[model samples]
Each structure stands twice: as structure tokens, then as C-alpha cells.
Target: MRAQPTAKSARCTACRIPSRRVHGFYWRSLGDVACFGRPILLLIRIRRFRCTIPECPRRTFAETLPGVARLPARQTDRLRSVHRAIGLALSGNPGARHAATLGVPISRSTLLHRVCSSDADPIPPVRVLSVDDWAWLKGSSYGTILCDLERRRVIDLLPDRSADLWRRG
Candidate 1:
């Protein structure tokens, strides 16, 4: 959909100072999730604002959408979240297939990138700790899973199952 922000003023991305003088606008294409059984592409009119502060480093900058999408994002945050979920559930080819069926056609590599780039949720303090070894190739390569016993959740995946870690366990 073609749309422009109705806000009277927008803050400079670099300086965070609000400006009403509109320098110009640029079109940004964002791949949003499907609607009405069809894929959605949003053509948003992003306003360019001249920095009112003379000392500010940026002379002109595009207004940010904040929670909607990142400045350099090609797809909406929600769509990326969906891709991340699909990747987490069934990474690589399987996830790409699933996403295509769901009306979000993203490449396997891109989907995997989304999953890796997504930030983990904040976890509570770990009162108790647990470690375990998992084989990457049926005992050929091993790694460690660090978990928080008090929260009953995984904290991180260590690359190696070292002897020091095993001794502590």
C-alpha cells in the first residue's frame, strides 16, 4: 500500500531532534506478511527532515519508524519474526518451503540469517546450572549445552565439550 506518515514533525535519526521542515520523501518497499490470502508489499513514503540543530552531524536524515521496521530493513519486523519462528522450527530448506506456503517467500539462507540475527529474550538469573554434551555427528563432534536449572531453560551452546567443563560437571 502507498502511504505516508501523518506526523507533523519527525526526529532526526542522528541527533534525535524533532524537525517540521520537510526536505523530501523517499519510497521504501517492505515485504510484509500475507493478507487476504495474498502476499503484501508496503510502499511507505518516508519523510526526509533537515536537522534544525546546526551543530548536529547529520544535515538531513530519514525519519525512523521505530517499532514498525528498522531503517535499513527490507521486510517488516513482524514478517522477519515469522521467518525467524519458521527457521527455528525447521531451519534451512524445510523452513523456506514452509514460509513460501505461508505466503512469505524467503530464501533458505535469508531465513536462516533471520533466525541467527534475532535476539533472545531476557532470562532471569540462573540460581542453578546444568551442562550436557550433544553429538554433532553421532560422536564425531561434541558440544555442550549450558542451561539454567532454576528457570529450566537453555542459556547457551558451547562449541566444545572441554575436559575442564566435564570435570566441573
Candidate 2:
């Protein structure tokens, strides 16, 4: 005979309540397994409950999955990592094409969004910096960029490169 699975009661990570009751079931697709070479799918029966405390802000919440990642996201954490890698390597149209070859469908605009959304730690402060100007619409408009030699990254962008702007920096 097979052992029957038991429904365990657990506290919510966000609300810190143990009064929640079982609510409903949902399906989630997990990342592919390297050793098994197969994708994992979780058929989870999530729990829901009303907040016993009247002062509590939230009234209802679903059971939390610590192993699972951001809620409502289609791809797993590993797949998101892969997408980020592709976005960094190729960038824009070329990156999208490369991702398609790797079985991940991505567009140039999507890649740009991902790149802009990255929240890596802020670069350290710089001592000496360089400013340069580039024409956006040739002979019509120009833009200026400030670069930090030590950080090796663009620190600021301005509408135009001017002596006043340099003094302000």
C-alpha cells in the first residue's frame, strides 16, 4: 500500500499568520532538470484563509511557496537567468535572434526592457571623470555623456555638452 499524503498547516511568510485554511489548486511549470534533462511541473493545492485579527490589513492570502519564485511569472527562476544572460550577450535585435536559436523567444524591445530593468548595485563613486558629446540627430540636436574612468561606466547624460554642464558636474 502507498502512504497517503498529509495536508500540513504552515504560517504565512508575509503576514505571519497560522490561521489560514486550504483554498484551491494551481499548476506551475518549474525549470528544466539538468541531470534528468526534463522540465518539472508542480501541481500544488494552495491554501487560503481569512485574517483572524481585525487590525490586520490583509484579509485573504494564498499559501506561500518558498521554492517557487515571483508570483504570476510564467518562466522559472533558472529560465529568467538564461534570458538575462542572452540579453546581456547579444543585446537588441541580435540578442533576440540568438535567444530564438536557443529555444527562448525574445524580441528586441523586450530585451531592452530587461536591460533597463536590471537593478544591480550602484557603481562606486569616481574621482576623475570625462565628458563627451554625440549628435543624436546630426546637425540638429546633440547629447552629452559623462564617464567615470575608474568605474568604466557612463555616470550621467545631458541634453547638450556645455561648459556650464561641466561646471555643474
Return the top candidate by lDDT. Answer: 1
What lDDT does candidate 2 reach at residue 78? 60
User: Candidate 2 regions off by >4 Å?
Assistant: 1-7, 26-46, 119-169
lDDT of each: 0.85, 0.63
Window of ten residues with lowest summed lDDT in model 2: 31-40
Per residue, candidate 2 scores C-alpha lDDT tens digits across 39-89 of: 344444555655565666877666555544457655455656666777888
User: TM-score for all predictions?
Assistant: 0.71, 0.49
For residue 147, what is the lDDT in candidate 2?
88
At residue 168, what lDDT does model 1 achieve? 69
lDDT per residue for candidate 1 within 63-152, as digits (tens), equals 888777885889888888888889999999999998888898899999889878845333577889998887777758989888898778
